[model samples]
Target: MHATTPPPSTWWSRNWKWCVPVLAALLLALFAAFVFGILMLVFGAMKSSEPYRHAMKQAQTDPAVTAALGAPIQAGWLVQGNFSSNGPDGEANLSIPLDGPKADGTLFVVAKKHAGEWRYETLAVNVDGGERIVLEDDAAMPLP
Candidate 1:
């Protein structure tokens, strides 16, 4: 007598009646993750800087701005995220915030090492109709 293979058992099985709830759960998890990812990407790094924290709070509740980033931004502006060589050959970063619709939001960045110096290729990002946040003068204070 020939032996018959029982059947395939997996998420994509044809007889997946028992998998509706499971599939639904998995899909829900995936959707949640997608949403969280989008939120993080849109908000940029949620690092713990006192200024940044304050900015975020302001951004959320500050009446004027629906939300605020740790700092403001400039168009075609480039500055080091930290105090470094200041030679434009180190690390650079910028933060921008949007109140609504993620599709129209984007962050700008430019990092490069040139002549033993760091240079920013691009800095500052913006929304369709919004003002760029201004980075405090002491935002990039050198570390003693």
Candidate 2:
């Protein structure tokens, strides 16, 4: 008599319904994680000193600031500050010292993030021996 052996069952043949859904869920979770990681990287880069430096550069070119300070921006003028974000909106506060020959003051920079880039909302300067100079938006500047 000849011996008959049963064929091994395939994975899909055994548990196709449950396995398909489980695999799809796992793939979806992985995709979400990948997207989240990318977002975190972007946000982290934005939080760096790059934006602060840009603000400082813009302040250097501002006519109002130059007229009030009456001095060219020097290297010794430090740029320092912090950044915070909530969803699509974000804020940065930069304390830029005016270490120039004619004046000494602090440029307070308030920036907001729109469309993935920071834009100056307000540039307020407090001169040590003069009045405050404020360059702001048409409406009231929002607090960070």
Candidate 3:
């Protein structure tokens, strides 16, 4: 005589036909959501930061970018051309709903790029739409 043993399942494998597809769908949805979230975050950062000239060029035509930044962008708006040295840079151009002010006055900015991110050695603000603030030292200045 011969004896045979039955396989055991932990409540999941036993429900293979149903569990598999459900798990696969859930996993697939999770992956899709994760990917979408990452994309939004990266794109949001890029959109919020207002990087460079090409982006500026795009901003001209993209109402969303324009509405996002509160103010019309112009060249020499970035830290390199605006500052005297390399360092952390931030443009509070877009708060949440809009970018910045458009009234006839200077745009004042007070910002800090979290430690280990970027250096803030030089800064400028076009107050009254004319002047741009700057630092007199090599070290980063407290946002003014």
Candidate 4:
């Protein structure tokens, strides 16, 4: 009745092949999740910036913008485009409610990137009466 310890059971019996793929998959999934989270944060920041918002606030007070869209009673902003590179041009869609006289519509704002900051380049507003007002930064020209 000598039971010989069952031949010491080889290392493969520990299921390392399955474990390796499982661990690799887990690591890959974690890497993907981390990359995704980082991208979301970056895009979120680029989509809207405090500087842009403050600029919009200031623009609302401008007589030109108010003259085109009437006194801005309320407003909302939406930043568009992928800002993955330095000096990437961005656009923001502005929805503003006017005081009166002019029917409210969308305002398309084009902004530029300089020294890692955003600056207003052009602003355009199209109203219901086929009227459009465009404000541009004549001092600065967009690079071709």
Considering every candidate listed, which one attains the maximal lDDT?
Answer: 2
lDDT of 3 at 40: 69
How would you encode candidate 4's per-residue C-alpha lDDT over 1-144 as one tens digit per residue? 877656676787788979899999999999999998987786567546643454455546666667766764344433444333345544443333333345565455556555655666556555657777665544355677
Mark the 10 consecutive residues where model 3 has the least summed lDDT: 76-85
Candidate 2 lDDT by residue in tens digits, 30-80: 999999898767545543554566655655777777776665865342356
Model 4: pairs clashing at backbone N, Cα or C within 3 Å:
none
Best by TM-score: 2
Candidate lDDT values, in order: 0.44, 0.70, 0.41, 0.57
Could you tell me how far off, in angstroms, the CA of residue 82 lies in candidate 3 after the best superposition? 20
| Candidate 4 Cα lDDT to native | 0.57
Q: Give one digit per residue, the lDDT tens place, for model 3 in 1-144.
A: 898887766776668889889999999999999998986665555444533322334334444333433466443322221211135434332211113444222222233344324333322333343443332322344666
TM-score, cand. 4 vs. native: 0.41
All candidates in order of TM-score, best leading: 2, 4, 3, 1
Please write out the lDDT profile of model 1 over residues 1-144, one tens digit for every residue: 999998777666865776788899999999999998886554444334233343334344433333433224221222224322335344435453333433233344434555664344443334455665332223334668
**Order of quality (lDDT):** 2, 4, 1, 3
Over 4 Å off in model 3, which ranges?
A: 1-14, 52-86, 89-144
Candidate 1 scores a C-alpha RMSD against the true structure in Å of: 10.8
